[model samples]
Target: MLSFTRGSFSDRLFFHHHSHLRALLQYRSTQRSLSVVGLLPLSIVMSGTRSINDMLMQAARSKKGAVAAGRPPASHIAVEKGKTEKKKEQKVSAPHEKMKESGERESGRKDKSPSTLEKSAVAKINEPCEKDNGTAVQNGIEAPMEIDSTREDKENGTIEEQKDSDMGLEEAKLPDSPDIPKISEKISLPPVGVSEVPSITECVSNLTKRQLEFDPKAAAFWKKGEHVPFAFLAHAFDMISCESGRIAMTDILTNVFRTIIFTTPEDLLPTVYLTANKVAPPHHGVELGIGDATIIKTIGETFGKSDAQVKSQLKALGDLGLVAKACRVNQRLMRKPLALTCAKVLKTFKEIAKETGKNSQENRRNKIKSLLVAAMDCEPLFIVRLAQGNLRIGLAEQTVLVALAHAAVLTEKPPVAAAQLPGRLEQAAQIIKQVYSNLPDFDQIVPALLRVGIQDLSEVCHFTPGVPVGPMLAKATKSISDILDKFQDIEFTCEYKYDGERAQVHYMDNGSVEIYSRNAECTTGKFPDVAGAMTRYKKDDVKSFVLDCEIVAYDREADHILPFQILSTRARKGVTLSSIKVQVCVFAFDLLYLNGKELLQEPLRVRREYLYQSFVEVPKEFSFAKAITSTDLEEIQAFLQDAVNHSCEGLIIKTLDKEATYEPAKRSNNWLKLKKDYMDSVGDSFDLVPIGAFHGRGKRTGVYGAFLLACYDEDTEEYQSICKIGTGFSEAVLEERSASLRANVIPTPKVQGRKCCGCFVSFLFL
Candidate 1:
């Protein structure tokens, strides 16, 4: 009798079926052969059967014990391990499995199918491991089996979806393991078929094509005291340029500012100036001094292109920044360059500005090339535009101030609540705007804001005696009647609107004087004679003061003021008191600061009194503006006539008391100018020709918005730029003019005697 104790069904079946054959062969063979063949088969079967039976019995006992204890048997554990291995394998191959399957199908292998074993394996792989409990015997151990439906799905080529699902599950569980590195931190591996590493240029091109995404966790990744990469600002500029709405631009800038504030507080000042397209405060007279020629040449040398090629690209693209970006995509650097930082760019700009004297152009080119070589993605675009001193993005100065204010408030310690943030931002923005108007210097305001907070920013950054303040502006009225109507029942004063450069004269207690233009540029070097004359005319008691005056070209012997065109002829730099050819008179109007005290908050009447008491006037050299305090329409008209006869533009009417505080950088209703051009009659007309046209924006799109007019100088046989005319044109007229000038537009301004206007008037007609 054969005892089938402790054997799996398959093992017992194999032994029983072969037992019959072994017995027959043993009976048919001779005694010797029977002993060798029949005994060999019998012995082998018995021995294997004995060992498998023992192992099966042991496994059966364990399964019984585990069932009683609510635990899986050993085979179920193996199945779990197999599933895990399969999942990992699937992850490694999931990216290419579909391609392999499709390739196999295309090669006339549609009839090919997976073996039964492979189908079973795939079925086991698809089953959910967490719900697996049923066990079936395999060899001698009990293993879990999968449903038939999964096997059928695999046969139908639906296993790709299962592979994807498994991969997603693995990724989901990754965060639970702290030792596992993140996907981004993992080293990138080459694709399956790729044999060679990508070139640097190819890598950069791929990176450039990828859209830039702003990461909210940027601040967390940056180490403390690390200089902010210039790429951050460049990215912000790219976003700002694409957005036409003010609010959207402000949001982008605010995020950038907030990041800079959190990561590198010291870089905030330079970053702000760069965003404003300035290298330093206007009073410092620091400029990039980089011209288009230098930029074109630098790009050519750096990228192995000719100047003509660069210019052709520039003309086609209409932006040198874009041209640089296009050229940079194909250029390869000798070695990996160090990443550019905000502070580094600003310092390089100052260095470029200092590149003067012999071989200065070459030095500037070298410095610019270093930056371009290090630039990646949109960096070259912004760097070129920065060197050009015009970002061309529609970012306004006030928008920058708003962004800065919001950033400071948001990044303040003991962070603000979400509900109160908008209100706080608005309040802080107003405070910043107020303080900046009083002192329009980021060098002073940004540091103060960061140190003392926006609450005390005004106290820390008030109007200093030496620092230039943005001059107050006036709104133009159509006629004297309009000015009288606006200032009805309000005491007002009329002063001659002198046709000269608006100069802010500052006299320091150290016996040194400085002159600044209305835009806050230091003109001390350009008007040394005016600086000397301020000392000669100041009162003995006045030690330091900031006087808002106009510097007009004057004829001292004839005691007459010359036209403003004559004033513009003087040398702009490297001027000495003795080298002055065009003499100018300082017509002081409003006193802004006196002896270290700010007079901006005082009424115009009080400021005028201070002005008159603080300075002594000399004829044709230094004097107060010709003024008359009156509201009579006839008297104002007569005064206007007198101003016109004196070569003044018109009359400026200012309020005496109510709402008359000096509002810096504002075209306020408190002051109005009655210009001769605003009158009904054509007071003056120029016989000039249009040399070039500027591209329009906003509603003036697709047409020339303005024309550069030049007057012929008979003595020099040259075309002198007189003015830019953008007004008094209807849509029909603009389109007509644009059509007429389109044919005459030349690739370059090749006229021999044309003066450079330093503007974006590229479509030259002459």
Candidate 2:
């Protein structure tokens, strides 16, 4: 490797800012009207100037002309330029170095030697300078005057000064900012420690060399098919990583090649994590119609330059919707990002290969491959990662276990973690991991999770009763501390939070647990456990009854909450006990039907009195989530704390007056979520680590645009991009991060990725 440390090239036809113009001239000279050389037309070159610079320039011009004609450059052009640039670095210095020869020649001239004139001509270099006399002179710049009494010395000095000065004018120029600063100057990047890499060049270079070496003949197929999508994804990846365009492109080829091949070539459908950028209500009407170009312009101005050239690039990004279309985009929203992992990517590709027959090129050619709409088939490994958002050999499973720990208040008992419940999605992933460690990739994981909880049964429900829940859960709270002190005598009631469908489980004693979802639609077959559990309930007054409770995953052996995952066990029917070990536990928390009345108008206190006075209480398997009511603020605070510790979403404070009527199916003001976490934090607080980021969209693109944060992998060192977070940032965060993150630009590209030993993200397809 030729490393450039310190040196100077001799007199050579180095390219100036006028290089393209010079090349244009060379192109014009070529009778071909297309050759590009240093200011000479191909006609001139063909007639022929045999200099190497002229030849290279001519070739460059020819290539440029071809591109203008809308043709791709032949591979030969890149190879040719590579060689030319290498050679130019080694060019000889100006002939002015022979100043000593100049004097010798002059003496020879005095001696009337024949070689005198030729030698003097060779020593003469092209240079001119005015001698403080303020006049343009054709002779070289004069050296500082030195008075020499010695006659021979004075004569030799004069000749040498003239020549050497001329040579000084021809030395090669130096590069800009040679000693590249570390990305994180404040924190040194140790060999293995997460270091700030100011730029992505070195890694990108290695990637480029690898690509050049990747199956040369398949170049046509891959090149024509890959470039644009690869380019865009790489660009997005770079923005997220804070790397430059070239570096992003380089990383794409190196790290992300396999994922790209397996994903949609045009839209890159595999990467589902990059939500289309849009202005959120983070700050309502902060500004309008502002674009990244504006931010770039401002940055340019700050740098004492203009963004005229960069505006178009920013425009291209906007057109692609990689940035918001709004005029004044909120800096916080624009900076929120999503990140993916390498392992997920590998699993996605492997699944695609398997589904399409790994080596069956002929089959793939025959198939009109469209796009990957759904994630790759769920692999065991994939499931483990999908839940944890990270995939190390043992890492993903650890996440679910932690979620279990949180739900069980394991963190509070000994570790005192802020969060507990492994939420629904995390609960599912944890289940998969708990059951299997060497989980399959995403392609294998997604489907199984979908089968259990995903209900496309839109045929039954209308509105999305519960929020989309986003990609992951924020936090759930039921704290009633604030409202408890207002009431003199709070009522404490325990009703079974039934596990079966809550949508008015209407059974006319017809030997059926005809249940609907939270939304009313008779889904009788979905939960056989709920049906079986209800049959065992000692309800002599339940000839025909309706109740409300959650459908839970139960383990008959433990008769306890199965880490919120026991729900998955009862998904499909006709199962032998050993097959899935599916069981059900019913927690009937309320009742809307008894005898022959619809109690929708009944007050919570009345219903509680009826439930407590009417039903029996059992522990573990079938009972309430457990609750206590109080008028004291301390008691309410205790409830909130205990609920949070119990993996519950804070506390649910409810009015208990007998006159307080039930507001069926409404998130009314009568009940409020006094969440412990939300009371102190903004938006929802998630323990996510930054995995990817983006340049700020419109307006705020100057500083760090946005960031991609993911849940941490306790076992595997990875972050799976789940949802693109775009809210709840304080100004101080942006101000501090703006300076710090510039150092840690991902050396690997996000679009594709460089080779990674662990799991990569496959969420681009989610």
Candidate 3:
């Protein structure tokens, strides 16, 4: 037997102790003329009587509420015990019917004075009256009523009996206070010097007007402190779905953030994360682990659609989210749905994450099905997209964060003027971006900004020992000449760009090391040997530090570094020192932190000096990236070739200026990736703007077989035909490109007579 009991009423309704009594007492206190102590018993009795009558009315209306009286509880043990136990008591009294009979009590007191009648009414409060046989009377009115269990009403247990079991309870209705004057009650305005008090009608009219002013969709969930429907977010997602311009996308994102700010300010973080198309912060690793199979199964279970039917919809729509939306709109529901809240959705995702081991797959399938069933139209669409991690809504995390900063300022009390807003908004965005670059968690940042302004958030955000910070990015340049042009007169240090994985290694004070990828994912388990190497070669003076470096596979016997492919062989999990084949060397370059101090704000030159002085590099296990400091192009050219000879990619030309501070998660000209691929004369590699492509057949079917390259026509601000190259690309590259084109390419007019080697060339705009 399944227990469907949803806990107790006190757990579901009242959040605090004696809440009903407190509410009643508080209401009576507002009227001063009423005796709160005397009204306590009267209030409870009235509340109980009203509840019994309401349940009886509901039972009379629907047979769904009916439950067998002699069913003998659910389980075998309870059945045996129930046969020996005493029969439960039952009594019924209708307050309205009892009030009509009050004339008898009043007639009996007709000869008595008004004070005597009042006393008589108070005296009969606890005594049982003879009327209706078992009905108890309180103050000439019906007291607490136990529901009758007579044969006619025996088909079902009363409301109180169902409270201990499965039947859903209706909301407890409180009786209206008799003290507050009704709209029909006479009232007179006070004389001179008295303040005006609103009448009951005026108060009710104002409340209705306020409700009318609120957004209907938001107001539905606002009273319960739940998230607005996903339909609202889907509308925003639709607005920016096809938009290409940055400004236009930013405008739409800002509008969405403003809506969240105004409607559910506390939900801002979860909303931001969902809109960013992630379940949690990048560093935290909260994957939904929901595969396409899981999504299909959930949709099938939810709508009773077969796998083939779902597949047909998916193939036609080309998006799982759209498939879900279509299925949801087309299918009829089995039962009333539970409302989908942003918080509820997030919590469900967390629950899914916790389902593990043997039965985990079935557990996940059921949970996801519940979520899909509870969600409607656009809600299931977003939920499916979120699970798939393919929210194709053009806005990125940066855009969302910028909009959040703007929201914080715009939604502040005593609104900021329009003219003064731009500058403050920019400052707020920069502050938020800076904090996010270090922390990168909206769960932490959003609440801090909401609690204390941006100023405090900036000060509060810091680099923790284990959590990964976004790696600093470098701008790309074609030549040393172009790089010099950007950093004119400033001497720059050119470091060899090793063809290896970029790793950020944190050496903690507790003698533990954690390594993270450039994307801030913890890859600590994948590089246990690297951790051992760091411990062996770590500087004694450096109690704790963060090293930004490259980890390349080392050919120990040959005394040379292997390519990235060799290092890629390392396992992502369950790595052991004994089974390790490919040995790696850490090429330390920039020191972002040293000895409990963050050097991100310090000059690159200063950080490099600390890096060189603090740690001694081991030969094949660890070493600093070879560097040459010079402003001369010829010297840099020679160094770049030497790097290429050593299986390196190219040179990373970094500014040697005092203000060349490390900017995380940013691409700045201060640090440039001077790669051979960008060189125009190299011929081996050419960066051509792709403006069109020709569809393939036979071996290259269903994809754009070859791309039509172009050069910028500055005067016309358009692309001109250059050359098409299709031979070099692999099947994987062609398929990836084809998928990208199919998703992002806009339709354009065909070239009537033009062909690239007997193939039709289809042009794209962006």
lDDT leader:
1
Instruction: Report the alpha-carbon TM-score of model 3 versus the true structure.
Output: 0.64
Q: Write the per-residue lDDT of candidate 3 for residues 307-390, one digit (tens) a residue.
A: 888877775676678888888787643233556767677777878877889999889888877778877756777788787776
**Winner by TM-score between candidate 3 and candidate 1:** 1
**1 against 2, candidate with superior TM-score:** 1
Q: Over all chains combined, what TM-score does candidate 1 have?
A: 0.65
In the range 164-261, model 1's lDDT, one tens digit per residue, is 12111122111223333223233122232332333223322221221123332342234557887887678768867777777877777877777677
Candidate 1: how many backbone clashes?
0
Query: Between which residue pairs do clashes occur in model 1?
Result: none
Q: For model 1, what is the alpha-carbon lDDT of residue 26?
A: 27
* Every model's TM-score: 0.65, 0.29, 0.64
Which sequence of candidate numbers ranks them by lDDT, best first?
A: 1, 3, 2
Give the alpha-carbon lDDT of every model.
Answer: 0.69, 0.35, 0.63
Q: Candidate 2: deviation at residue 235, Å?
A: 38
